[model samples]
Target: MNRRRRQWALKKNLLRAAVLSFAVSCASNAAFADDEHRGRDDDHSGRHPKVEHVLLVSFDGLHEQDVARCIASNACPNIALLAKAGTTYTNAHTPGLSDSFPGLAALVTGGTPKTAGLFYDVSYDRTLYAPSDTSCTGLQGWNVVFDETTGIDAMNGGALTHLDGGGGFNPQAIPHAKIDGVCKPVYPHDYLKTNTVFEVIKQKLPGARTAWADKHAWGYDWLNGPSGRGVDDLMRTEINSTDPATGTDYTDVYSHTEKFDDLHVQAIINQIDGKDSKGDATVGVPTLLGTNFQTLSVAQKAPVAKGGGYLDASFTPGPQVSAAIGYLDTSLGRMVAELKQRGLYRSTAIIVTSKHGQSPADHTKLVKNGDTLSKLLESNNYFDASGNFGQANTKSGSLNDGTGLTGTGFIQTDDVGLVWLRDQKQLAAAVKTLKDNLSCNAPGICADGPGAYILYGAPLRARFGNPAEGRTPDIIVQPNPGVIYTTSTKKDAEHGGNAPDDNHLGLVVFVPGAPGAGERVRDRVETTQVAPTILQMLGLAPKLLKAVVSEGTQPLPGCEERRF
Candidate 1:
C-alpha cells in the first residue's frame, strides 16, 4: 500500500480502538449499576458486592510517572501486580493545593480546600485567635501550626521525644475559635469544614470499624473529621521524633524512614490479624484501614549525593529512591499476603495513591531561594515592626523556630508561595513587588522566570477561593518548577505546589477477582473521588459524606463498573 493509504489505515484503526474502549466502559458501568440495584433489592442492605474491607495506602511523593516507570521496568513488582488485576488511573491528580493537609483531606473528605478549609498543614486562619489567647480577644489572624510540635510536648517547651506524638495534640497549641458566642479551643478535627469518609462510614455502618496511620500524631488528627471520633484506631507514630538509634529524626535518612514506615506496616499487619494498631489489643479487623509511607517522600527530598531523589526529569530513581520503591513494594506484598492468609483477599479492595508528588523531578532545574519570599515581604513592609507576618505565639520563644507559630505574615513556601497578607488592602502592592522583582539576579522569587507566575486578585480567588474568607491565601506565587523557596541544602526537591510534578499522582483501585484485568483508564480523575468510591465499595451512601454532597464527587469509573 502507498504511504497515504497506510497512514489512513492506522488512523482508522485508532478510531476503532477508541470507540471500542468507550463502548466497553459504558457497558461495564451499566452492568455494575444494574448489579447494585439488584443487590439492594435482594439483600435489603446497601452494601455492594465482593468488597468487605477497603485498604487505602498512600505512598507520599509517588507520581503517576513513577508508577509507570517502575511497572515498566519491573521495579515495583507489588504495585505492578495490583495494576495487573485492577484499573490504573494514569491521569489522576490532587484536587487543589498539594500540601499534605489539603491533599489528604481531598482524599478522605471528597472536597478541596475551597470546601474543606484546609490549605496547608501549617497555615493561617484569620478567623481563629492565637493559641495563647483562648478568650477570643485581640488579634485574630492566627498562624495555625498543626505539625508534630502541636503535640503535648509544646506544653512543656516542645520536645518530640515519644513516638505517640507526645501523647497527642497539646491543648496549649490549639487555636481558639468563637462559636455561638462561646470561645472554644479548636482541635485538628474541628479545623475541617466538611466530614470525612471515616465519619460517613461510622454513621452509615454503625458496626464498621475505621482506622488510620500516618506520620504526624497531631497534624493528622484532622483525618478523624469534625467529630474527632470518626477513626476508631488512629495510630500516633510520629515521624519527626528523634530515633534513639540514629540520634536524628526518622526523615533524616531514607533507610531510617523505611524503619519508621515499618512501624505502620506492622500495625497494618496486626490489624489484619484481628488486633488493634498496637498488636496488643483484639479490637477486630477494621473495615477501613491504611497508612501513608514516607520513605519515598524522604528519598525524593534527599540530595542526589546521598543516593536519593530522581536521576533525571524522566523520573528514573536514584539509589535511595530505587531502594525506597523496592521497600514499599515489598511492604505492599506483605499486606497482600496477609490478606490472602486470612482468606480476605477476594473480599477486600485495595487503593494505592499518593498525598502529593515531589516537584522538579528534573534536578537540573532546581532553584533554592532560601526563604527569600518571606524576607522580601518583610523588607517591603508586608509585616509588622516585630517582623511578625501573620505568624505569632512562639511557644518556643524564637522566630520560625520550627516548633511553634513564629513567623511574620502567613507565608508558606515549598515549590510554591502561599501568602496570606496581614492586610488584604496590600494585595495589589504585594503583587507589584513580586512582579517588579522578577529577576534571577536577586536571591528572591522570580515571577516571570521559567515556570514562574503570580496569582492574585480575582484570578487567584476564582481558582482557590475568596481570600476574604480567611483561610485562602491572598496571593499565590508558583515559581519555576524546581525553584523551592528554601535555604535548606539537605534536600533537592519539595511538594505542596500546583506544578505538574507536584500534583500528578499515582492511583490504582484493585479488587481481587474483579474483571478488566490490566485495564488502564486514561481519563482524568481527582483524588477527591476516592472518598465516595470507598463508601460505594462498602455499600454505604456516598452522599452521607457532607463533602460528597457539596462537591458532587462521583465514584471512580472502573471501581463500581468492574464488579468483583
Candidate 2:
C-alpha cells in the first residue's frame, strides 16, 4: 500500500449519536455479520451501533466524473442524489496497469498484482520452464489454472467453448490443472489463492450478512476469485459448473445488462420487501446489499424517460455519457426505493464504485506516437519473416513450416506489445537490432535498459519459466502513455495501463447513517485498502486477508486511522 499518502480512515467523532440511533433502529434485524461473532452478545459488545452489513457495487467502466458529469448533463439524477447523501472520491484510482485482472484483484484482496503474480492476464511466471516452441497450439502462459467465464463470455453465452477451442484461450495447458494424465476442468474460484475481505467478515461478523453484485468479467473476478474470501451469497455472471450448489447462477450469462443489475436488485429487493424465496424471514433489514450498473452507458440520476431509455442514440448528452449515467441512476433509484420501502434504510452501508475508468481507444496524439514504435520494429526486422515469426496458440499464431519459422506478425494485448522470434539463439541479435533501430522509431518506445524506459523484453526462459502457464513472453513492449494499438477495428474508449485516466477509478460509500456518510472525501485511497477496510469494519483480522491485498503491485496503500 502507498504510505506517502494522507491517513484515509480517520474515524469521525460525530458518528456517536448516529451510531446509537442505528443500534436502536436496526437491533431487530441485522446482527454479527457471520459465524465469527458467535460468542459475542449484541447488547453488551462495546462497539456501539456497529455495521450490520456492507454492500459493495462495482460498475464496469465508470469514472468519478460519471457521477458529477452525467448529473450536470442531466442524465443521472439518482446517482447524483446518492453522492449528495454520501462521499465521492474524485481522485480514486486503481493499480498502475488498469487491466481487468490486476485492477479488480487490487480492489477485493487489497493485494497488488506483483504479489498475486497478476501483472497482466498474460504475464511472465519465473517458476515453470516453457518449451522453446511458439505456436497457436501453445496455450501455456497465464497463471490461472482454469478458464474463467467472465462478462465477456457470459455476455456471449454461458459457455467459453469458443474462447477455449481457439487454442489461444485454452486453460488445459496451464500446469496447475494440467491433468494430461486425466483431464479435469478447474472452476473459477480455484484460481485465487488469497482470501478476500468477505472471508474476514465470515470470520469476524458472526451474524452480519454480506453480499455483492457487479459487471460481467469483473463480477466473477471478485465473486468467485479473491473477493469470495467471505461472502455467503453472491450474484454474478461466472459460468462455474459448481456455482449452482453455492447459490450462484451456473448459466445465466446471456441475460440483458438491465437484468444483470436487476437480478441482484430483485434478490435484495425481495429481501427488503420482506419475502424470502421460501417466504421464511419477514421483510427486514439485511446485513448487506449491493449491485452495480453500467454508468458509462446510462445516466445515474434520472428516471427512465419513456422510449428515450438513454440508450437511444437520439437522446441528449451525445449518447455516450447519457446512457451510462442514466442506467446508473436507474439502478440506484431502484435500490434506494427498495431500502426506503423496507424501513431499514437508516442502517445500511452502500458502496458504489467502478471497475475502471474510460479512455479514448483512438486518441489523436496517441495515434501518431504509436507509429514511431511500429517503425522501430520494422527497421529492426522484428516484423520480418526471417527475423520474427509466430507459432502462437491460435489462428493468429505462426505455422511450423519445418524450419521452425512461422508468421511475421505481432500480438498486441492491452497496451503491451509482444514479439515472437523464430529462433531462441537469435535473442541477442534481436535486442541489438532493436536498440540500433530504436531512435528512428522514436515516439512509441523507450530502450528500457535503465531508468525511465518503456520497452522491455527477454528470453521466456530467463524472465518467466514456462510458456504453457501463459506466463512467459519473448519480448515485452509497453507503449508511451496515451498511445494504443491502431488495428483494423477501432474503438472510442480503451483502458489497460497505469496511466492516471486508466488507473484512477471512481469510488462512493453510502452507509445509511454514519456521521461521515454524506460527506464527499477527496482524499486519495488505493483499491487495496478496500479489502482491509472491509475486514476492519467487520472487526476481522486483516492478516487473514493479506494474501489478497496488493502491497507492491498496485498504487493502493494500507488503511490508516486518523492519528491526530
lDDT for every model? 0.80, 0.46
Candidate 1 local lDDT, 1-564, one digit each (tens): 699999999999887765433111211111123333443222233332356788999999999999999999999888887887678899999975798988999899889888898988878877887667667875677788788867776455556788887785776668888999999999899999999999888888868899899998887888889998999999988898888887888988888899999998999999999999999999888899999999999999999877879898899999988999999999999997787677666567889999999988888988786777777887888865455453344546643233344224578888888998868888889888888877655745755655578888888776678988888898888887788888788999999988889999999887644467678889999999898888877767678888888778887877643321
**Model 2 weakest lDDT span, ten residues long:** 22-31
Best by TM-score: 1
Q: How would you encode candidate 2's per-residue C-alpha lDDT over 1-564 as one tens digit per residue?
A: 444233333333445434433111111222112211332322334343455556566776666655656756666666666666555666778755566566667666777554444554433332222222223243333222222432233222234333122222223223233445433333345445466665565566666555554444332443445443455445433323223233443322212334445555676676566554223556343455555554342221122222112332222343434554566567777776666555444445566776565443223323323444445556655555333422233232322111222233344444445544423346567666655544424533543322213333433333323333333345555554444455323333456655445666777665443334335566687776666555544445456665543242222222222222
Candidate 1 lowest-lDDT run of ten = 22-31
lDDT of 1 at 331: 96
Q: Could you tell me how far off, in angstroms, the CA of residue 28 lies in candidate 1 after the best superposition?
A: 12
Please report how far candidate 2 places residue 13 from its true position, in Å: 21
TM-score for predicted model 2 compared with the true structure:
0.62
Pairs in steric clash, model 1: 47-539, 388-408, 389-408, 389-409, 390-409
Candidate 1's error at 529, in angstroms?
Answer: 1.2
